[model samples]
Target: MADQDPPKKPSSGLRPIERLNSEERLSRLTPATATATHHEYCSKFARDFLDAHFYYCSSKFVVARGGKVKALDEAFREAESWFSKALDWIAATEKIEIPLFYESREVQVSHSFAGRLLRLLMQYDRIFAETLYSLNCGSITADSRETTTVIAAKRIKSIQQLCIPDTDKFAPDGTLLNSSRSQTHGHA
Candidate 1:
């Protein structure tokens, strides 16, 4: 018979067995061997305290900074490999030219996809809360956040920053706050 092309291998979507298996043989654990895994005997709370705290702090800080909130940084880190495939993803850069509070002055805010999440926090950025602007504390970062982890022992040099006071925080009736001020919160 004339030479014919061999049948093509069926495309079974999987990695080669040898490539997936460990190159080196794994050694069995012996009495002397100490594995990195440890069984800590503590209350379930103490065991997960750090992780819980991290999630809380990360989410709170992210929202306060007007950034998109992720479900969990740990989960994000874990799934990054699997979810990084940009098969259906678009790498297009998008931006919205909206005036935001940078240094008490209205500056055009532009960033890579900042319009998606940053807009939540940026919406409230205004000196006067006459309209939808709820009036918010200025983005004030101190040179020495001594109370925080920034300061080792002594206070470092601080930045001389300023913010335009939110005038809408006051009641239009010209009286002390008698109603709820939950919606209109500012660090003035």
Candidate 2:
């Protein structure tokens, strides 16, 4: 009989374990953690409220000074209520800590991360409330627009400081900071 190559064995209907193994390997290699996407989204929403408030403040200042006091007052009042809603949302979100699933990491790191995020969110909320309160009392006079502007600037600065100190905690992927910086810097 002529020599012939041995027939290849058919694959065992079992989908190759390699795929499962690879997935398992990837999961293991990457830290097994649940992300705080909800918290982040809420924070971003709060920030947006602040942005809107600032825009309203500037426009109101200009319009009010231009003697359109009625329209400016209306816009300011609207901004104030919007800020209040944002503050409430942030407070509610901070009350809940969405746990991340990590593979046996030290509790301190996890706690620290949660703590920092909570603190930053709270700080932003407080600042928003304070700004609104000041605006409501007419603390920012039309003549002292510079002073009011300074106050607004300080509140924003404080928020930036809080956010920058622990970027990793609040924004592990740097997406938030990057987007904000790019937008602000581009305008500048």
Candidate 3:
């Protein structure tokens, strides 16, 4: 044959042999390895708990401060969405019926996640309940009201600091709150 172009190699590049071997091993994972993987995944899911708690506290602050609850409501909903994702992952791990189980990382992570979630939910529940009781009672003294306002403001500031790395940008001004309250009551 006259000088013809050499037969072209396939366009797809070859995968490294080591990578292929590793993937094969991963696919054929033993129970212990699988559990370890699950544990790692669950551990990562803990961030969702923090995010959800942050938003829930934000919602409470919004309500406490007489701000429009809609925005914070949406934020809380988003937190719930993250919590649902975590729950879904936990549920999947529960379905994995492994007998003769060693104390795998997955089992440890699962217990940790469960405990964290429970405590967070319970704490928020109590906070919300107390807030509602305070609101409905509507008989708090002026000093008590001022103290509550200050605490709510502090909580908002704390949550903002948690969620935003640059706290300065999101910082709340206690002076502004005080000025507004004074003006509203014709104190100054």
Better of 2 and 3 by TM-score: 2
Q: Of the candidates shown, which would achieve the greatest lDDT relative to the real structure?
A: 2
TM-scores for every predicted model: 0.13, 0.24, 0.22
Q: How accurate is candidate 3 locally (lDDT)?
A: 0.34
Residue 51 in candidate 2, Cα distance off native in Å: 15
Task: Give the least accurate 10-residue stretch of model 2, judged by summed lDDT.
Answer: 102-111
Q: What would you estimate as the lDDT of candidate 1?
A: 0.23
Off by over 4 Å in 1: 1-113, 126-128, 131-188
lDDT of residue 138 for candidate 1: 20
- Among residues 3 or more apart in sequence or in different chains, the pairs in candidate 2 whose N, CA or C atoms overlap within 3 Å are none
Residue 176, model 2: Cα distance from true site in angstroms = 20
Clashes of each: 0, 0, 0
Off by over 4 Å in 3: 1-68, 94-188
Error of 3 at 44 (Å): 16
Residue by residue across 11-59, what tens digits does model 1's lDDT show? Answer: 8877565411121211111212212211221222222322222122222
Candidate number with the higher lDDT (1 or 3): 3
Give the TM-score (vs. native) of candidate 1.
0.13
Highest TM-score model number: 2
